[model samples]
Target: MSVRWSFSWEDEEWLATRTPPADNNLKLAIETLIVPFGRSWQAVDNYLEVWRNMELEHGAEYSVSTPSAAVERISRDTVEIGDLYDQFEDVRLPVDEFVTLLTDLSAAMRNQ
Candidate 1:
């Protein structure tokens, strides 16, 4: 599954809504990470740098050898990673990758 990653740098208020007393973490993430690249490769690259540094606060962190699992993990962390519409809610234009995935999924479901 392809995942979309975005954090809007243009909107600072986005950070105030994450991780509990999330006054800083969430906003910083949105403003500096995804807003610039939107759903592009550069955007995901930025997130990967940060994600790799995270320790999850209460569990073990292990090396991820599988590309599929790594993508899933990143997608899960972005909340709306699997979403096709939200990338346009506050960010710039998105790539067609998400649109393609959703379309295929819809067709498959219809066929079922």
Candidate 2:
């Protein structure tokens, strides 16, 4: 089986998402995109910028927890908005797969 991004409703977590997130995995779905858009604007790279930066980041420098250090932690190929305090368990994806999610979604949205 493979995984894909999605905007969902009617889940056990739906009610919790309504009020606020206690920190959760950043799902790169349409609805999930709205979370970072509304809450993490500083970290939200524009769609084009996300792709542009991918060419710049060279190595896999990332963390499993929310980013708290004073480093340029954001990678061009990765969206490492670690631990958004909306839920538990950070969702980690391979760099290429992660970028594919953003690119594919971007294309789909453009077509619509």
Candidate 3:
């Protein structure tokens, strides 16, 4: 699946005022993005564990075409999502874009 991020007008205004935001503003942005990102990671890990258990219990009936592929996709997405937080120092997305990224990341995790 592919996710696209978009910015809202309010986000535009907020970002416009603070390309390189004050330390406090940056901290607030990080906090806002990280909490949900962490939650999504937890949820994805739980889901993968449950899926593995179901497959173990049910054999072929519960088998997927490629279980490793699913895991890899989730891992890749998670890493990419996590990178948003990790690389925040190098990038300054608008608030709306940041929010959109978080929302999209969460959706990707849940969909998995």
List TM-scores for all candidates, in order: 0.22, 0.42, 0.27
The number of the candidate with the highest TM-score is: 2
Ranked by lDDT, the better of candidates 1 and 2 is: 2
- Order of models, best TM-score first: 2, 3, 1
Q: lDDT score, residue 32, model 1? A: 38
Which residue pairs collide in model 2, if any? Answer: 21-86, 22-85, 22-86, 23-85, 23-86, 23-87, 24-86, 24-87
For candidate 1, what is the TM-score? Answer: 0.22
Model 3 alpha-carbon miss at residue 52, Å: 35
Looking at candidate 2, the ten consecutive residues that score lowest on lDDT are 12-21
Return the candidate ranking by lDDT, descending.
Answer: 2, 3, 1
Q: Which scores higher on lDDT, 1 or 3?
A: 3
Candidate 2 lDDT over 47-69, as tens digits, reads: 43644453455444533222321
Q: Which stretches of candidate 1 lie over 4 Å from their true place?
A: 1-16, 24-26, 45-112
Per-residue alpha-carbon lDDT of candidate 1 for residues 15-105, written as tens digits (9 for 90 to 100): 1122223234333333332333333444344344444554253123322221211212323222222222332222222224323332333
lDDT of 3 by residue, 1-112 (tens): 2324322224222111223334654444434433432435464344545545754565423322122111111221121112233434422433244434545444544554
lDDT of each candidate versus the true structure: 0.31, 0.38, 0.36
Candidate 2: lDDT of 50? 44
